[model samples]
Target: MGNGYLRFAALGDSTTVGLGDPLPGGGWRGWARLLVESLQASYDVSFCNVALSGATAAVVREQQLDQALAHRPDLASLLVGVNDTLRSTWDPDRLHADLDHVAGALVDGGATLLTVRWHDHAALLGLPRVLVRPMAERITRVNEVYDDLHATYGGLRLDLALMPEVTDRTCWSIDRFHPSELGHRALARAWAERLCAAGLDFPLPSLEAGGGREPSWRRDVAWMVTEGAPWFGRRARDLGPWAVRRALAAAR
Candidate 1:
């Protein structure tokens, strides 16, 4: 049915990069890979994951969009903007414009565009109390942009807020940012369900969470000390003052 060969290209940030779901031999085998495997039973699926770590929406447009489009994919998933919300330079209009351009191109090129409405990541991260409201507002605006894009282009949009497992600690990796192996499998299963409902003739991916390394408390602490702390420090430098200013303005 259809083309018999499905070209699926993933464009976004680290989550799409599969950071939380590492392969045994190395590298990441995220939701995109799992979804592709499910499609294998019904069609020849060609997958390209061009998502980068810490990529903003603008970054995706400028960098990854061309790479994804070059593959001439029949299915495209754009799951970015959380990085944008974290930065002081976040601009919803610009986010909308960048996403619009990417979504428009995908739709016009005959690809089934996929988007995401992110959840309350700030709450989950337990960011500083000062930043909670502002970050939530930013995520809301970002979701609004996705809403506009979905209204215009008409595609599958996954809303992470509805996923009960999103708030579960087990669903998150050590970084507490990216999804764990179980989380990635859940996401892949969700996508498979959506695709099947949309008439994709593919077997559903197994919901069983296996094949990834188990989490270790020692590894978690090590990563937090090495990777997480530095990342938080960098973001605090930028987002801290911004949050303070927003708070002050709100008080006024």
Candidate 2:
């Protein structure tokens, strides 16, 4: 029935496409996929991922935004701006404008929005930390803009860069710039919790306080922007929500 179905699309950059954690399966399992499997049972969800590996806000403004909109989804997610900051050699103002433009496009597309946070951790990763912190702050400024737009439009927004769980070096990618596989799982779990708190009523794993667990979905989201595929669908593979209910029943 229409009541049980949801169409979702993802638009952004490398993280959205799963560049940080490449799998041998030939498909990069990112956070969006985690989201897909998480909701597959409760909602007859169709997912379209149109994220590029090195997209800037400008690139998204020009290209992928249209592709995502074409999917006609009810739920849409974006994870852009890192490349905008990392590659902006012309003007900072332009980068900020690009952010606005892309967000505007998604809004126009009539999809509920979710924005990922930006971060830099070379310092925590044992690098000199001189590289991307300033860039990260500029990213922070842009994320604030994203926040305003989401609030104004009545949507969800967050920043992955300032997340506490990601301070540990283990969360960084092998290159120390992206998030690791573990980081992706944490991200998916967090976002599920966010949607739940927002009255989404989706299935989610319990957060354990001994490991920084709380009602705070923000911490998990802060760990990684990308969600890997292998980590998702673990509990709900093959079986329906009835299977999930059965598992819960057995646990009791």
Candidate 3:
């Protein structure tokens, strides 16, 4: 799509790029891509994915935001701040400014904002002591800022948190960081529901439409008891191409 052709332009990190579980394009197919297609079909719209790998909120603003702005989308979605916590790089001031820039730019382009937060679903239940505290803190801080920012920016909608089960467990396969095919679908569905609530109102690209029933991810997550899995000890990094590619293919 050309500049302005896309009604939505998504920004942020791996989640933005769909680094959940690689499908076919060296990138994964997750909620971000699903949201784009669903919005297009449900609203008769188009979108651009300007998501990059390893994007922190600061980097996203300084780098990707301008490129996304060039699309002049009718809507903009962002799920940043994960990396900030991962790298211990949280900066409330810069985050606020960049967030304003993103929202303001979207408004100028006649689009709305879709604000989101991502915390590893695994940070609940029996998560290790070290991991739980920091992760919880990050989620709290990020959500707080996100809520405040969206409140100030009228057309913005605060989407829900990540899929608890899929994220919290080893649903991703061996690496256990990004979402697996199943995990990606769960994420996509959750996102679709939020958009539907925001008035997608129809089922063109929604899971409620012709798409297969609740991809395995959502189903598996729903039933998981968190009783039989290894806990996350270290922070996560990016994934390999095979994984990313698998995710993209699934999305297509």
All candidates' lDDT scores? 0.89, 0.63, 0.59
The residue-by-residue lDDT of candidate 2 on 127-205, one tens digit each, is 2233335444656666676666666665666567557767866555644556555566567677787877876667763
Give residue 21's error in model 3 in angstroms.
2.8
Candidate with top lDDT is: 1
Clashing pairs in 2: 29-228, 29-229, 30-227, 31-227, 117-159, 117-160
Clashes of each: 0, 6, 20
- The stretch of ten residues in a row with the least summed lDDT in candidate 3 is 227-236
Residues 59-110 of candidate 3: C-alpha lDDT, one tens digit per residue: 8778888888887776777777766655434576777777777767766777
Better of 1 and 3 by TM-score: 1
Which model, 2 or 3, shows the larger lDDT?
A: 2
Worst 10 residues of 1 by lDDT: 207-216
Error of 2 at 126 (Å): 4.9
For candidate 3, the lDDT comes to 0.59
Clashes of 1: 0
TM-score per candidate, chains pooled: 0.96, 0.72, 0.68
Winner on lDDT (1 vs 3): 1
